[model samples]
Target: MLRFCPLSRIDGQKTFVIMERKGDKGNGKQTQKRIAPPQYDEAFKAGAIRMVTEQGRPSTEVAKELGICIDTLRSWLKAAGVQAGQADRQNRDSRRTRELEAEVRALRKQQAEKDEVIDVLKKSVGILSRP
Candidate 1:
C-alpha cells in the first residue's frame, strides 16, 4: 500500500508532504523520495512580471521578494518580450547624443564669430587702400 500525505504546516514551520510505502520493510529495498520543483500559478507569474515591467522595479528585487532566483525572473521577463537593461542603455545613448549635439552647436557659433571678424578686417583694408 502507498500512502501520500498532503502538505502541512505547523507553528510557523515550513510546509512538507509525507509519503509512506507499506510491506517493504523486510525486503531491504530502499526508496528515495523525490522532491519536485515548486510551481507558480499564472496569476502569480503575471504579478511578478508586472512588478518588474510596469512598476519599473529591478528583476533582482522582484525575484528576492518572490523567493525565486534572479535568473528565473529574468527568463520570465524575456519571454514576455521585455529586455533587461535595455532602458538604461537607451538612456545613456540619448544622453550622449544630446551632449554631442550641444558641442556641435557651440563650435558652429564660434566659427561664425571668427568669420564675422575676418570680414570686418577685410573691409577696413579695402577702405584704406581706396584712399
Candidate 2:
C-alpha cells in the first residue's frame, strides 16, 4: 500500500512530498517512508534558468546558491534551450563590446579637445593679424 502524506512547505515556498509505503519484511509487515523530489513552481524554474542564461552565472554556482543539485539546474537550462557554454560566450562578447565602446568614446573626447585647441589658436591668430 502507498500513501501520500500532507505536503510540507520549506522556505515558505517550496513543497516536498513524503510517501509512505507498507510491505512485508518476510516476518510480518513493515512500513517505509520515502521522500519524493520537491516540486518547483514555474517562477522558480524560470528564475533558476535566468540565473544561468541571462545573468551568466554558472549552473553549479546557481545550484549551490539555491540549495539544489547542479544536474537539476542543468536540466532546467536544457529545457529552456540554453547551452552550457552559451552564457560564458555571451558574457565575453558583451565585455568586449563594452570595452570597445569605451575606447571609442575616449578617442572621440580626445579629438574634441584637440579641435577646441585648434579653434582657440585660430581665434588668437585672427586677433593678432587684425591691427
Candidate 3:
C-alpha cells in the first residue's frame, strides 16, 4: 500500500500534489526514480503485438515468452489499436483501485472532521478544566 502525505500549507493556500511513497530516501528530499527504458525498438514492439493480435496468443503467455511485463505488453498492444481480453480487465481493475483509494481519503477526512467536533463538544462540556 502506498502512503500519501498532504502537502504543507504555504501562505494559507492549499495546493494539491500527489507523489508516490515508493523509493523515498526519507531525508526530507523526495526524488523520482526511473528505470532504464527497455531496448525494444519499433519493429520489436510491432512484432510483439503481432504475436498476440495475429497469432491469437494470450497476452499473459505472449508477455511471458517475450520476457516482458503483462502491463507493458498490453500497453504496447493498446497503443497499436489492438484490443486484448486483458486490456479491459486491466482498465477496470485500475479504475477500481483508484476509486477505492479516493473513497478511503474521503472517509479519513470525514473522520477527522468528526473528531474535531467531538473535541470541541468535550471542551464545552468541561471535560477538561483549564486554569
In model 3, the runs with Cα more than 4 Å from the true position are 1-35, 86-131
- Each candidate's TM vs. the true structure? 0.43, 0.53, 0.39
**Candidate order, TM-score descending:** 2, 1, 3
RMSD of 3: 26.7
Q: How do these models rank on lDDT, best leading?
A: 2, 3, 1
lDDT of each: 0.72, 0.75, 0.72
Q: Write the per-residue lDDT of candidate 3 for residues 45-126, one digit (tens) a residue.
A: 9898887766556788889998989889888978988777765455556668889999999999999999999999998889
Q: Which ten residues in a row have the lowest lDDT in candidate 2?
A: 16-25
Alpha-carbon RMSD, each predicted model: 7.7, 6.4, 26.7
| Ten contiguous residues minimizing lDDT sum, candidate 1 | 11-20
Assess the local accuracy of residue 75 in candidate 3 as a C-alpha lDDT between 0 and 100: 84
lDDT for predicted candidate 3 compared with the true structure: 0.72
Model 1 lDDT tens row, 17-127 = 444466556666544443445667788888988887676666777889999887777777788887757633554566688899999999999999999999999999999
lDDT of 2 at 44: 99
What is the model-wide C-alpha lDDT for candidate 1?
0.72
